[model samples]
Target: MDDGVRNTREWSPPPPASPSLVVRSPRQTVSRLRTRRTHRDWDPSLGRPSFAARDHGPKPSEVYGFVGSITTVIATAVYLAWAYTPEPCLRSLGITYVPSKYWALAVPSFVIVAVALSMVIYIGLNFLATPPPTSFSTMFDENSRERMAFSPAMEEERPIEPILDIGVVQINNLMFGDT
Candidate 1:
């Protein structure tokens, strides 16, 4: 009978997580200690803060970004002046510590080339590291999980499968097969 077949199928509830499996950390202990220390002056049973702190000024990152952008803009202006301004004008202005004018043209071009080369190298590395078309990993790997099976009738109502990794052969058959 169908019931006999169902009974024969292996069925067991997942085991409960053991105490040994639970992970404890010094960070959690330190956090608890800090909380207890902060609440020592007042009983926390009422659930109210002792004092509210006011908003601090701009964060360190915001300050850094503002300074960095200003510095870059100033440096760019100086570089442009040094590179494009005539040598007589620079001499007349009593500014002579600037480096060779040739560097201004070369440095930006070199940076552009380096960025483009880095992009190409990154794409090449990705292509080299990717699994081939015939590799079994295309179907399943250590991280691959099986899709939960459902009744054939239920398939019609469900619009999407849980997993999205459709096989090349399946796609090819779907798109180009005989009706």
Candidate 2:
């Protein structure tokens, strides 16, 4: 006797005349919704001016000279006090001065002279090495205005180019003859 149940191998559902619903996966539905929302908000013509393009006025580096000068003066004063102060105070703190047999008197004097020389060198270097100060008006001059106007929208967005080591690269290429 044949069982009333249909064979397990064969199964089919009747097709609808019109598609009832396009069964999208949950991820696809969410992505499609986000895309639609983004497109709706986007305006092709009305691009916002970039930070570089905007006339934000004087750069911080222009005022850095004034601050640097003040700091350098203070630093020099502190260095002079530290270097030239008496060794007696240090000796009172139980720091013994074991002078060498050959140059007992000369060692301490030499150290003091060296320290003074170093301080002078440091101060001189700082004074001589500094960039010339830009005036407040010149800092915000026409050149800066032109720079701000012509600067690209994605100036900050560009990836930093790694500093090229041509010598190293050439040496490696010569040794390896291209892998």
Candidate 3:
């Protein structure tokens, strides 16, 4: 805290370039990156800028998420202002050239309807792909197996059948005395 230096822009004799950054070959360093950085970054000690200075901007990946979140917040604020602001008040605020208020309501309404419709479509697709309880495939398909005799080698081959639909009469008898 008491270095007497003002800030991060510590204007001192630049530190020696690390072995990794020192890419000198045949007199001049490979200056493919010199064009990217401004002349302000030129170090008198090194004679020219290196690729390290060109990397001052934020990484592409980091910018996407940060910008997306900020954009969403700004868009939401603008949408709310557009929806609730009174026309005369807006006009007084110098916002004269605007679309109809009906669009503000209609856009959100359409978006909500679209989201609801997508959910319905998802459910409909699931229903379309599934066989109903009463479908013939539910009772028996070509893959259905008949009950086989118990193997004497092992009485507990299986305690009960693996996959078979129960009879409606058996279900009714269990639930109703009249059955």
Candidate 4:
């Protein structure tokens, strides 16, 4: 793979030569730029434009993202103004179409509380579903897949097997000096 990459890098095709147009004045510069031919625009082999050449504009997703960002900023400003502005001032300015600002705080607070409660419920469910430490499922569950074991004498010849689970006794002995 390395040799193939090195060979290709060393013998890659040279880029097409850029056209040189002598510009008489600043006025000609703009015209020359409009007519300028890049390697992408011209093909040296056929002396014409390449069939693959395309002037792709921004993708639909890119346009959507730009519009979405602008919309979000505008909406945020509107929400902040509606939520924070004094009721007396808004009435004085003849602005009565806006909904009550209570929703602005209530909606966000409700979302936060819902998310926190969901996490707590999920944790409780997991605890309820867990098997006890003394259960046989701890050593060999229905879902557990066993790896093939190799003899110690033939370990070097055989490929290394994935790690197998050890008992808590072994773990405690290794970490706590057999206490």
Against the true structure, what is every candidate's RMSD? Answer: 21.0, 30.4, 16.8, 12.1
TM-score of each: 0.52, 0.21, 0.44, 0.55
For residues 45-146, what per-residue lDDT tens digits would candidate 4 score against the true structure?
545443555566899999999999999999999889889998888889998777877898998899999999999999999988999888988677555545
Report lDDT (CA) for all predictions: 0.73, 0.58, 0.73, 0.73
Using TM-score as the yardstick, the better of models 1 and 3 is: 1
- Listed per model in order, the count of residue pairs whose N, CA or C atoms clash below 3 Å is 0, 0, 0, 0
**Residue 36 lDDT (model 2):** 58
lDDT of 2: 0.58
Give the better candidate number (2 or 3) by lDDT: 3
Q: Which residue ranges in model 4 land beyond 4 Å of their true spot?
A: 1-51, 143-179
Alpha-carbon runs more than 4 Å astray in model 2? 1-102, 133-179
lDDT of 1 by residue, 125-153 (tens): 99999999899986777666555567888
lDDT per residue (tens digit) for residues 1-179 in model 3: 43332122433444768756654585354464453443444445545455765557888889999999999999999888988899999999999987888999899899999999999999999999989988878666776665566777886565766776555565688889563
Q: Which lDDT tens digits does candidate 2 get at residues 1-179?
A: 23322112332444755767657699987896676532122233446543544468777887798789999999878555445555676477675663334454566689999999999999999977765576455234443322122247778886654543334445678999876
Q: Regarding TM-score, does 1 or 4 come out ahead?
A: 4
What is the lDDT ranking, best to worst?
4, 1, 3, 2
